[model samples]
Target: MIHFEISSYNPVLLTNSPLNIGVVETTLDALGERLLVIDRRGKVITQRLVPANNKLAIIVPFEYTVNNNLMCILLDDDAEKDGELVDNVKAAVIDMKNYTPPV
Candidate 1:
């Protein structure tokens, strides 16, 4: 599972309105939080007992290096609308160290 802190959220754009999401390290850990992200291949990226807001919380496709794997994540669900559902973008970084897709 990938791990991330809500405090690390970097707003992609400026906004005059206050962010609806509470600014706290524990904000993503509340009970009943059901955040999820699916990869381009449709694999469910897993996460610990973490959480988030009404937004779909999707991360734009980006590349990263982890232990020389040179892997890519942040699956694009192609949602009809933005921030509609808690899909791909669940974690800032997905650790593929031991990930094995289900058969």
Candidate 2:
């Protein structure tokens, strides 16, 4: 079975490999309101300051591969905010699946 280790203190979690979108969906749903990501310091950093439309999501695709593509959400817990909240976001990765990105 796939396991997604979630932690509120750890802002970013990674999976060893790209998990199936279906699995990702289930994992995310099970997380409920815990998907929110905070800074490494475990502090909620306000990162938005503008207005946005109805769309409230972001997907980034690169290297001509959809499976490896990552999806994320930058949330602003305010009635007035815009753009991604930067460090205040969560990624589709688990602790076991996480890897160090090459520089």
Candidate 3:
């Protein structure tokens, strides 16, 4: 079983208008071989190849402005063969509030 320690910050600030916001920081605890970010509808929003280090950061593009609840799942190398019940981590609900549109 792969165990992952995931933590995240809330409401990442996007100061630059029409630009990418601050990065979303996450730690995989050096467990899974890959990380998948899924949306509410079980859709794969993004995927990251887990690195050797435990730290992983994701950048939110300017196009995404809706408040979305994403699911971060860590899969082992042999995830397809053996369905191991590893740790289940829910990523932070990204809501960009207090963002004033350009006039």
Candidate 4:
């Protein structure tokens, strides 16, 4: 099993409408020292490898018409595995939608 230290935080999305999306942070051991961001929808929007000390942040846009929230997952270059990532992403998105963060 993969041991991932997952953390979630609120981030502001830069856009005309703007958005308050939840950002999930995790480190992929398989990809060396890379951080992964799993959005509320469990989708991988952007992934890049930087120094471990570097801060990782992401912003998601809220739908203006539907008022629906969006999510994004960050992955690194070597961590880009189509099959596993996609499956995990799908599951993550489902969890995000129904996830209720503790107060």
Best by lDDT: 3
Candidate 1 matches the true fold with a TM-score of 0.22
- Global Cα lDDT for candidate 4: 0.40
Residue 68 Cα positional deviation in candidate 3, in Å, after optimal superposition: 4.1
RMSD of 4: 18.2
> How far is 72's C-alpha from truth in model 2 (Å)?
0.7
What is the lDDT, from 0 to 100, of the residue 2 in candidate 2? 95
User: Which candidate should be chosen as best, given TM-score against the real structure?
Assistant: 3
What is the C-alpha lDDT profile of model 4 across 1-103, one tens digit per residue? Answer: 9898759877876445432444433333354444443444555455556455444433333331133333333344565563224223221221234445332
Clashing pairs in 4: 37-73, 37-74, 39-72, 40-71, 41-93, 43-73
TM-score on alpha carbons, each prediction: 0.22, 0.19, 0.48, 0.28
Candidate scoring better on lDDT of 1 and 3 = 3
> In model 1, which regions exceed 4 Å deviation?
1-31, 51-84, 87-103
Cα error of candidate 3 at position 46, Å = 1.2
lDDT per residue, candidate 2, 1-103, as tens digits? 9998766575575544554221122122211222332334444322222222232222212221323322333444442444242332333332323333222
Q: How accurate is candidate 2 locally (lDDT)?
A: 0.31
Ranking, TM-score, top scorer first: 3, 4, 1, 2
Runs of candidate 4 with Cα error greater than 4 angstroms are 1-19, 30-44, 53-57, 62-103
